[model samples]
Target chain A: MSTILECKNLSKAYGGKTALSHVSLSLNGGHIIGLLGPNGSGKTTLIKLINGLLTPSEGSLLVGGHPVGVESKRITSYLPDQSYLNANLKIKEIISYFDDFYNDFDKARAYDMLEKLSIHPEAKLKTMSKGTKEKVQLILVMSRRAKLYILDEPIAGVDPAARDYILNTILSNYEEDATILISTHLISDIENILDEVIFIKDGQIVLNSSVDKIREENGKSVDSLFREVFKC
Target chain B: MAWNLNSDRPIFMQLIEIIQISIISGKYAPGSKLPSVRDLASEAAVNPNTMQKALAELERSGLVFSQRTSGRFITEDVAMIEDLKSTLAKEKMKQFLESMRQLGFQKEETLALMSKFLKGDHS
Candidate 1:
């Protein structure tokens, strides 16, 4: 497998405070990895750096062997923690916008997912419930056939049923060459789907290993281990 | 059968057990084509790589086999399936006896209780 993401001594700072320090990581393609940490543990900082929203204050980062730039942006799809969609636009209009923006966007696949949820293309985003809006946003983000999918807390704030839908959508979508990096503290909910996990704490990587290896070697689940490692 | 995996053990091992039980129980009939790895992974809500590892173990154990063009299939060896079924049953029986022993029941008493329960003697 190819190295889809690589970070060398990556660090980020906000004025006087350090968010991430010397965080070196390498992610391979064709796996679902969990970027797990508590709130303010630099999960978002790492994601932003990879998405080119923020430049790393120190060290170098690369996606698909190239530095984070237009080339990387073309192949990376990011779903931030907050809602970035316009509430005034209808679902169909959003689909059109995504299609116009992303060359790899599959409009038909997006519509199919919407129809499965009974979400009408004419329905305005503001008229839908939060859960439905999240679903729509997820569908739009996943519609792109990008190489790397960086999802920041995709399952947080959603109900169990909707969480299952989101996970299933992630599983069914994406090609064999793509990699998905899901950032969340909800480990147990998504542990079953992850091949590997990176535990971040206070902006530093505390653990990075395959989920099965962790369970086999420690005889404990990743969720339990996370609690033990980051316990207050 | 559903994939009821726990977080305590390696998921691939649990998958092996589940598939083995399914095979011995005739849920996946002998010589039947197993679903694609992708389908199995999605249904089980697991990483395809993990599912692939489990399937590879099953294949190595002679319970399952794959054809380059057709896909994976259960072994047609009825005798081998029967042997596996009895092995699994014996393992379960051993665990039941062990638990009964822990509950302070002697082997003979446990056997008697088991027979009585088998006869529908609820009282």
Candidate 2:
């Protein structure tokens, strides 16, 4: 498989405090990787760097072997930690917006997902619940034929049923060769679906290994191992 | 149909056992085509790559075979299926015997208890 994302000696700092320090990692195509860390652990910083939202203070960051730029952004679909849609627009209008913005966006797939969720096309964004909005954003992002997908806390603060729906949607969508990078503190819910996990602690890459290897070697689930590693 | 996998073991291994049992129990009859990897992965709520790995392992063991155009199919060899069933049954029997021995039950007493239970004696 080709390398989809790589960072060499990547570091980020805000004034006197450091968010990520000398972190280096590479991701391959056709994987569902978990970027797991506690809050304030540089998970968001790494994600932002990949999405080209913030420039690195030192070292290099590359997406699809290209430095973070228009080319990289064009092939990378990102679901931000916060909802960023216009509240006044209807669901259909937002779909059109994405259709116009991204050449790879699939309008039919987006609408099909919306209909599956029982979300009417005429429903306005402001009226939908928070969980519903997250689903919409995820559906839009996954509908793209991007090579790399960066999902920032996709299941946070949602009910368990809604989380299952979101996870199923993620699994059913996406091409086989594309890669997905999901950052979350809730490890157990998504552990089964993860191919590998990169545990980030205080902005440093602590552990990177396949989920199956972790379970086989450590004789414990990723959730248990994470609890033992990041215990306070 | 539930893939009730435990967290302590590797998932692909569990998937292999699950599919093996499905075959032996006639849930998935011999010579039947298996579902696509994507469908199986979604049904089990696991990564498709992991499912593929499990299917590959099964193919290696001759429990399943794949054709170029058609997907995957369970083997039609009944003797091989019977061999797998006996192996699993022996493993379970060994475990049961070990547990009974741990409880300090002798061979004669264990046989007596099993005979009584098989005779539908509740007391």
Candidate 3:
């Protein structure tokens, strides 16, 4: 598999406070990678950098062999930690909005997920619960056929059932060769879906290896290992 | 079918064992088509690469075979399944005896106890 995203000595600074230090890693295609860290550890910053929302302060950040720009944006589908869509729009309208915005958005896939989740596209986003809105947002994001999907805290706030639905939608969708980089502190929930995990702390990568390697060598799950590594 | 996995062990190893049990126990009947790697991965809630590796291992062991144009299928050989079942039982009994030995019981006494349990003893 080819490399989809590569970061070399990538750093981010706002004013004098550095949110991310010199972090370096290269991710290959056809993988579900966990970008795991506690809160305020620059997971969101790294995701934003990959999504082209912020420029790296020092080093190279590439998506599909090119720097973060129009090309990278075209290939990367991003879901931020907070809600980004308008609450005033109906679900159907939001679907159309995404359809107009991203060329890779698959309308059929989105509708299929909506139907399965029993979400009415005609219903107003404001009328739904927070979990339902999150599900809607997730469905829209996963329906894209992008090369790289950078999801920030995708399963944090949702209930267990919705989390399963979101994970299933994610697994069932996406191209086989595309890569998914999901950032979250909820390690146990998403650990099963991940092929590899990159454990970051204070903006530095602490561990990067295959899940099987970690389990076989340490005889523990990623969640337990995470607790041991990041114990406060 | 649902896949039950413990976070303590390697996923590929558990996946191979569970899938083998399914095949041998007729949950996935002989000569039947198996799910695609992606669907199976999603069903098992594990990585697709891991599922692919397990299937490849099964294929190597003659429990599974693939048709290039279509997909993988369980072996139609009932003898092979029976052979695997016996092998698994032997492994289980060996482990059982080892645990009994750890509890300070000899093999003969353990067999006698097992026989008594199987004999419908109330006490």
Candidate 4:
């Protein structure tokens, strides 16, 4: 298996607060890796670093064997935990923007997904509900045929039915050779789909392993082990 | 086909078992086309990755074969499914016999329980 992403001693800080500290990890192609941590545990920071939205204060990140930069951004599709689209834009306008910017973006798939969600292309982002907006954002990000997908809290704050929909969309849209790194604290819901998991706490990696190896070695499900390791 | 899932087991493993049972029962007949991974995932309300893993496992066991663009299909080899069924059946019977023996049941009592259960007019 070829390495799709590699991070070496990555560190990030905001003023006096440390969001990540010397984190090192590598992901292979075709992996659905779960990035797990509690609140303030640096999950978002790590994702941002990988997405090149924020440069690491120290260390290096290589996406598809290239350093994090404009080139890396082209091959990386990101879905932030919160909506980042302008509220004034219509759903169709946002799709056009993605189509123009991302060479790999599939406009037909995005439209198909929107239709499935019953979202009208003429609907304004400002007028839609929070959950609806989130769904739209997800549809846009997932329609891109990027080599790496960095999804932060994809299912957070959604109802159970919508959560299932979001997860299903992710599964259906991702390319076979791509690597999807989903950051979430919702372990139980995603524990089954994950091929590998990297647990972060206090700005540091605490556990990282393939799901099969973890289950075989620990004799416990990933959810149970997460509860044990991150017990409060 | 519906799966008899155990909460204790992982969903993907249960999915593999369900597909195997389908093969055994001829619901997914030999050489017949199996459902797309996306369709199966949607039907089961599971992540596509989970379904993909199950399909991959099936492929490894020679119980299913994929044709790239055409999608996955049940393997034409009936022996593979029969082998899996026999292995699983033997393991299950072993556990049942062990439990009965631990409960102080002799061979005669075990036979009696089987006969009594089989004779019932189950609706």
What is the lDDT of every predicted structure here? 0.93, 0.94, 0.91, 0.86
What's the C-alpha lDDT at position B46 in model 4? 58
DockQ, all candidates in order: 0.85, 0.91, 0.82, 0.35
Better of 2 and 4 by TM-score: 2
Question: Mind giving the per-residue lDDT tens digits that candidate 2 earns over A1-232?
Answer: 8999999999999998999999999999999999999899999999999998999999998899889999999999999999888999999999999999999999999989999999988999999988888888999999999999999999996898888878888999988999999999889889889999999999899999999999999999999999999999
Taking all chains together, the TM-score of candidate 1 against the true structure is 0.97
- TM-score, chain B, each candidate: 0.95, 0.96, 0.94, 0.82
The best candidate in terms of DockQ: 2
Question: Which CAPRI category fits model 4?
Answer: acceptable
Please give, for residues A208-230, the per-residue lDDT of candidate 3 as tens digits.
99888999999999999999999
Fnat measured on candidate 3: 0.77
Q: Is candidate 2 or candidate 3 better by TM-score?
A: 2
Report the poorest 10 consecutive residues by lDDT, candidate 1 chain B: B1-10
The alpha-carbon interface RMSD of model 1 comes to: 0.7
Candidate 1: where is the Cα deviation over 4 Å?
none
Query: Could you list the CA RMSD of all candidates, in the order they appear?
Result: 1.2, 1.0, 1.3, 3.1
Candidate achieving higher DockQ, 1 or 3: 1
By descending DockQ, how would the candidates be arranged? 2, 1, 3, 4
Fnat of candidate 4: 0.19
Docking class of 2: high
Clash pairs, candidate 4, are: none
Q: Candidate 3, overall lDDT?
A: 0.91
- Candidate 3 predicts chain B with a TM-score of 0.94
Query: Residue A87: error of model 1 in Å?
Result: 1.3
